[model samples]
Target: MDLSIINQIRSAFENLPDYRKPGNNLKYAVEDAALSAFAVFFTQSPSFLDYQQRMQKLHNRNNAQSIFGVHQIPSTSQIGNLLDPIAPETLFPVLAEMGDRLYTQGYLEPFISIGDTLLVALDGTDSFSSEKISCPCCTQQTLKNGPTLYRHTLVTPVIVAPGQSRVLPLPPEFVRVQDGVDKQDCELAAAKRWLTTWGAHYAPRGITVLGDDLYCHQPFCEAVRAQHMDFLLVCKPDSHALLYEWVTDFERTGEVQTIEKSRWNGKQRMTERYRYLNQVPLRNSDDALMVNWCEVTILNAKQQVVYRNAWASSHTLDEHNVVEIVAAGRARWKIENENNNVLKNHGYHFEHNFAHGKQHLSNFLATLNLLAFLAHTSLEWLDEAYHAVQTAAPSRRTFFENLRTLLQFIPFDHWQHLMQFMLYGENLLPRKT
Candidate 1:
């Protein structure tokens, strides 16, 4: 564990007012719970309770005092209870600021690319859903037998690029249907809400939001445009009948630019065909939304078609940037394959049964997990100690395995102490020999 990183995080926490004061008095002052929760994430722990116990044992064994000013460690139940009453306003903004810090500090550049075009992929994911457990913020639905069920939240991350291993998670807005709203909230609705909330923050950076076909709708496009942002939304033939009809007509006339190419990778040969429509109307209205559309078809050495996809974007069309735009649009899958999949199926066990409290616990835990992932990713990208370990290990799994084994036996005074031990030998004191 690196004390510098821990100090950075502690400073961020200290910036927020102590909830125990007169107005919002901090009933709990155990910052160790927050710190341990983050640490346990990287250890692949199943829950925060496990993290708390591990931290306590480590501290007691090492006779460790406070890492910073945070001396006390609360029980897992107290941590959950403390988090339950926390307002979203108090916690989420700090997380968002962390993302911004990572960006400004250059720790996030590897994951977030800035080139001729900046692409941001957005998608909503459910953090928790249950039939038995219920909370005030949970979205409820009636069962066929008339019993009610509840869901926790749908989080949307403003991902920078696809296939890039790292993702800077934005502060998510939880979606819960109102009591008398009489509407079922979906991903698109949540996306719209996200746009309204955090869209302005990224506007100066000029991002091109990428989404699936569901986001190609008229209203969604309008929302993106209203935010002064661009979009590259998937355009499926089944859904965009009118738009496809126009494309078909244009292709028949040979008016669209079509490029056919082929390549060989060792024993495998691949062929691709690309088509582009520089300017096409998204809808059939008098003031139609004009967009640039492109498609790519790929065939393997066997001449078997391997992949095919199409997309539309609000960006103005240019012959030079068409392929780049299409590539960025295609990279949207990375959010699912890299970020979401890694969190869910990888050692993180993102879907594991963590405590589900009455208030913001679930979301808070999820956010902490994401922050941990971000921290790990940052170390992999930036920290020399992490890089050395990764190079020495057989694979990422092996590296983490060694890390977990080390954590079980060693008691770290701070995160930096752990990192120092990993980089140099455990006997190498911070002071000179």
Candidate 2:
């Protein structure tokens, strides 16, 4: 609602622990370096700070200082050097704050579904990869021939709902080699870390974690329940032998439950079959965890099977709630389509290597990029002015392109003025005397 959101983020950067000793090169504070990097991501322009710096020299003021609270604009290299050592977790508080603001403003009501539970989709993605350029934090793999592959991967968790386009992401966990650990990091390990760290914080939101078949194992499901959360993870028959074996046995006696519903597809009627089995063993062990299994199959007007899928859930499957549970499980794809795809392919340039520092630069920049996305999402959710302008624009890329072009030529004294000028072409500059 207010530009104080920007200030709050600036404060988080300002409070970062400065590893550099006192010297003349301290012309720019750590906050300036961090905020400067964020401004580039926020504007979706690589030379945003360069343009602002030129504006500062010509007009004696720049949007970087006025809107983002940057005192001195730092060079791109300086930004990388300054932020490399700072842990990405330093910005986790800002992410939590963003979610709280949205919730407090009553914007999070639509995200709540499946009987008071918020669906959180978990998935991993590579942020940086290079066969030659490598860092100590990089995870490596040997190829078939000779060359090794080095990459940085992180687990992304976002709040999603069925038929919802918007997704709110939580702080990511990097999959990398730890100090005392011997084995290479993995998605499941990073996911377990994320659960251990933030699960309690989000537990009050009534979260139901969702993931692919990789997370349907016994240990991970137990971890989810241990945090007082629920899960509806994709379970494949091939990977889950014992579970499906039990399911096959249940089918012999017709112990499995089935419900078929008919709905018109605007052209003709179609049938959707829901099959479920409760209290099924998840694995072959004697102490295996028991979970509910459900499947959904859709047939077209010609009675041809068009789609089918199954899942394992912590909640019991029943005739009344099975449909809702299946829908929530299907929404997990939003993380891949709406969040990850948008960030990587859309304007965010998520996979683009902005900076690859020796220590933590790649992941740190990724975090700042995520925060920029969160900032824009918050503005769209809360600020009517921003929403109107963005909606009026032809596309997201065109919207940022207009902003960058205007900022290169015009200097606004306030963020609201920029939005107003873009919306109605109202010149808010002070009158000449």
Candidate 3:
């Protein structure tokens, strides 16, 4: 049972329900259309299949067949038409399978932080928007002085760690209209659904959920606690008046404690001050949830404050581990910088409308795009050759550019051959099955 990654993904697509009538346009399999769309996102080349089709005509060989096992490349419109009716949930099993492989291989060990706990950050980002293009699933909002804008958004959760560049993404929950619900979908509701769907699976692994101040309220925090999971959410002074009032009272009694450390940044010394209080009521009520509060302030040698923020945590804060807890809380930003920003700015073209079918085309294509990113991240952790070449290149865009250029001119037997050629200018050996 030597199943390669590509083969495993192919099997997942093979099980997609076919919506077409029997004996109608049987030239392309559903797997072919789905994998064809995936190939474009994988190689970061929109015309990837077109180049392969040309190569198949000229040289009787194409990387689509050899590498991706795409026998017959479908047109872009054909790909959209084939995938429009298919729900995005069908592809989730593939993500789970890949993540399982990574965990089994012990590649996910570095992602654990705060003593045997994994940090999962949650946030929402708009996927597509237009004043003209619209779908039944698109949530629309009317401007005060302009036309109504319809857009698609998703609540994305990713596994993050302090000082780690890579963040492993979990399956996203799309924010759209629900049957029998009069109001439009919201991020908080979608987040709760996501937790309910994935909580049991991840709870046993000792997980802590992280989010912005918007998620610091009782209903959502209680939802997280209901799943037997922990949380470390940003808490602002203005928003959490009751909690700050308790802290102010603690300060009056001198119960609050402070710890400061100095570090040299090759030019000057900087100061990091930490202040914390344990077991404070989060709101003004008898049944309010009690949580630990911590804040970090950075100062320069001139006693000038540089940055400051605070958070509420389910885990008790102490003098020994307050710094680590604060660092873990700060790592929440990686969900924005490392994951969302790279997806949008670094060659993924996340907001670009690749296919906006009337039904599920936009979301399905977006899922494929995200899956491509997850697959690449897995390779970075598991494949030595991939990591080597990726490090050898100047940037991420440059690495993909090299791959597309080589794939355009050369016909390789498989992914290993392509990688070896890129590394050594020749196929050194066959990939182990």
Candidate 4:
């Protein structure tokens, strides 16, 4: 991890307006509290601060202060108290700035296609939920027993590509009850807010938003067009009666095009059939947007279709690029598998309730976790020292295990020292500075 990045993050938190009573002088620094919270996620350990605070007592130094730039360690309750009032939106700039750096360094180029258009997959996942615990921001729904269950859902937009395993994410939008709105909040509403607020961040660079059938409708597509961006959304036939009716009608006219090929998948011969239609009306209305639709099916030797999907695209569908478009569309799974699954099942503990303050603590903690994940991803991909450690580790779990182990037992003056210890397979001492 870059020290400069942590410095910038600390600065961002420090610069956030305290919003506390001007007459009151807080004992703990707000930025330090925030950084301590981030350190919890960064280390993937809720007890990270307790252990580091012990180290500070014994050695007069702590990993949280040294590695993440925390000047004062705050209790978990204090961390939530200091961060509750600051909206998660305050952290969006950090995500954007980090992405700009990644792009400038050409780390994001592999995700580019269709003339600088990066594929941004959008989806919602549950961040936290409890049947008994609830906050003002939590979305409430009556359960089968007539008891209300409160939950938080987050809409994540990530930069992804078909062949790439690594995915980079933008700041997520939380789906929750707002101050002035009486309507029941939902993921689509959060997504709309995400696109309107952050869409400009991506439009200048070219973006093609990817989502499921929930976003394939006319209004959402119009929203994408309004931002001067494009969309490649999953279009399920069951939901689009008129659109499929048009396709069925076009089938009678022999206007639908198809391509077939056979390939070996090591175990069986797979036959892929791709079908496409260009300039099809998205709805039956006279003013329907003319979208390009493509569908693909993969059949096994048993002649059973093993995989099937369709996408409605803003780009023109043609023989030359339809396969590429479909491949990119299929990559939407990375948002679920590579991003959400990692956060939940890996080490980040997305569903765990680290904090649930009265106001913004839940969302703020989630954003901090995302920022830490982003930092680690950048290190994994862009830092040579980190890459050396990654190459030597047996798996991602083991890599983070080694990091946490070192942070607990050892002290290093530089991040690369830990990398060197792992890479060289030797017991090492902290470098003399």
Candidate 5:
């Protein structure tokens, strides 16, 4: 086993405060419970702890204790009850540490996009909803003539690049009930809170925030600018009528011009049309922030429009770097396709409701799952052994399925041994089956 990496995973959970009464000695340590909760996500199994319990009974050891540093396995209810009260922020520092590790290991070098900036995509995703299931942290909206819908949402940010498919995730910010507020929490509000909490964390890094049309508004753009961060927000003509109106006026006045270029994407050649204005007012208000506006359209060989989008930015739009800027902006889909979709649909089963409690359970479990993904992605990027195992499997789903099957048949003394068997087809695996 890579003790160093395993120790890092163990330490992330160790950082959470134990909210349980100390005088009431518990069967499992708080770190153990948190790690046990995390193990479910790590293995992509719903009954990870149940199998580990059986493993302990049969072999006197289990992967939870061996690989996860969990002294005692936690029941599903116990894990939820234990983790429900701990704020998700309690585990955020570990994400920064993980990023730092990746940076030091040179794993993040390929993720740097144009302008030496890390493209961070921001979007909110609904975690769960149930008419009967409601928690203090749940957001509720009453239907027009039906039962109120209780749901949970989180704003996820992930670092992406133009061509690199691997996206490194940042610690998420949950949209939950807030103090001293009568109105329901919203995605934009949650993003601001996210920026306030982690802006300084990103201030020193070369970051360019990417988002949908909803984030192209003045206040949101201003907040990102205030953080000393750049932005490439989707600016639709309909939504930014005043801005587009300015574009029309500038074109008539000959102040607005376009820079067109043709580039080949593999065998297919396409024309890129770029229309930009260096300085423009964002809104009709006199005090509106001055910003750069640009639009890009791609046409194929037949001259049929293939793709088109407009954006507002803090950088000047010019022919020298328009393609790179567009690529960075277009990477916003990575947050949805590579990050959120993988979490929800692919194999993480993120929205499957591991367990929900009255307080922070739903969001907390989601956080743990994301951390697990970060850990695995880190390994895939940094560890040759894990990479070798991945190559041996036909697909990611097969790799995880084989891992869970191996865990059930026998207990591996270390994580490395399991990978060794998978990679070499060695007889080192004990046969409890």
Candidate 6:
């Protein structure tokens, strides 16, 4: 933690009054909430009260009030009560602003390529949904034996080129039942809303959105085109029966192109085959959209084929950029492996039960934890001093372990002072001057 960065974050919090000013003489400010949320990631605790208790013991000698910047730190019940009443709208913007700041401060530039096109991947994940912990946003179901209930959210991230290490998250939209309405919410509907809202903001920058086979429908493609954005959505044989039928019809007329090649990888040989269809209509309707389709196959030296896939894109592919588009489309898996998987299975424990307030507590805490991750990722990607400390350590895990250990034992007036000590490997007290 760098005090300078913490100060900058504090300054950002100053502008968000909803997080701070709820009533007269409220002890804790928004900064405390933000800090408590951040602490959950490193500690992997189940509740904000537990996080506060840990922080107080580690840094404030059990004096939670002093550590949390109030006359007294709010109890776990207080935190839950406070969070349940607040709206999710207030916190999401702050997280988005932090992301913007990370970009403006040059932390994200290295991961992004200097090109006219950017790849934004859209995916849906169930972050908070439980039959027991039901909220207004929970989706209900009816079982053959009884009633049913659940919740879900659609997560969209602005990723750079494929295989890149960073993927910045956009605000998520929870899918819940509508009052007096009888339609069950789906990911496609959520995605449509996401695009209409945030997607419009980035369409002018020439973004290409990527998604799974479910997004290759005519309506979805038309919606994306309406937003002035392109798409590279997966197209499976089973789902695109009409398109495959058309391809089969066209192939009989010799209207398809195929390329095959072989290469050696030291111990083994590999083969790759590419099949393409250009300027094909996506549907049979009179105003059907045109798209490009490509399929890839790979075989190993054992004479066994190892990989197969297909994709459909709004971008017209020629010899010059077909490979690039395919690569970008294939890279959508990174969001699953690097972002979602890391948050859940790795140290972040994103699925771990934190607090689920009646209102926005769970969502707000989730937003804060994500912001901390983004901040940490930016530091890893951009900050020279922070990078130096990691470079000296054996690995990133080791670096974080040591960093946490130091935070537990040492008390500093600010975050930068702690960073300075870590970088220099010296005991330096907060400056009196």
Tens digits of per-residue lDDT for model 2 on 243-300? 9998999999999999999999899899999999999999989999999999999999
lDDT of each: 0.70, 0.90, 0.89, 0.87, 0.84, 0.67
Q: Could you give candidate 4's per-residue lDDT for residues 1-433 as a string of tens digits?
A: 5666777787788887687787686888888888898888988888888888888888898778777878889888888888999888999899878888898889888999754699999999998999988888899889998888899999999999988999999988999987788998999889999989988877898999999999898989999999999999999999878888888889899999999989999999999999999888888798999999999999999999999999999999888888889998999999999999999999999889987888888888899989988988887776777776676778989988888888887766666555677666633334446
TM-score, model 2 to reference:
0.96
Model 1 per-residue lDDT tens digits across residues 101-156: 66678655555433434577877776777888877777877889987878766655
**Which ten contiguous residues of candidate 5 have the minimum total lDDT?**
424-433
CA shift of 109, model 4, Å: 1.1
Q: How accurate is candidate 1 locally (lDDT)?
A: 0.70
Candidate 1 deviant stretches above 4 angstroms: 1-4, 15-30, 46-70, 105-115, 141-149, 178-180, 424-433
Worst 10 residues of 3 by lDDT: 424-433
Where in model 5 is the C-alpha error above 4 Å? 22-25, 263-269, 426-433
lDDT of 5 at 378: 85
Instruction: Mark the regions of model 4 whose C-alpha exceeds 4 Å error after superposition.
Output: 23-25, 426-433
- How close is each model in CA RMSD to the real structure? 3.7, 2.4, 2.6, 2.1, 2.8, 4.1
- Per-candidate TM-score against the hidden true structure: 0.86, 0.96, 0.96, 0.96, 0.94, 0.85
* lDDT tens digits, residue span 324-366, model 3: 9999999999999999998899988888999899999999989
Clashing pairs in 4: none
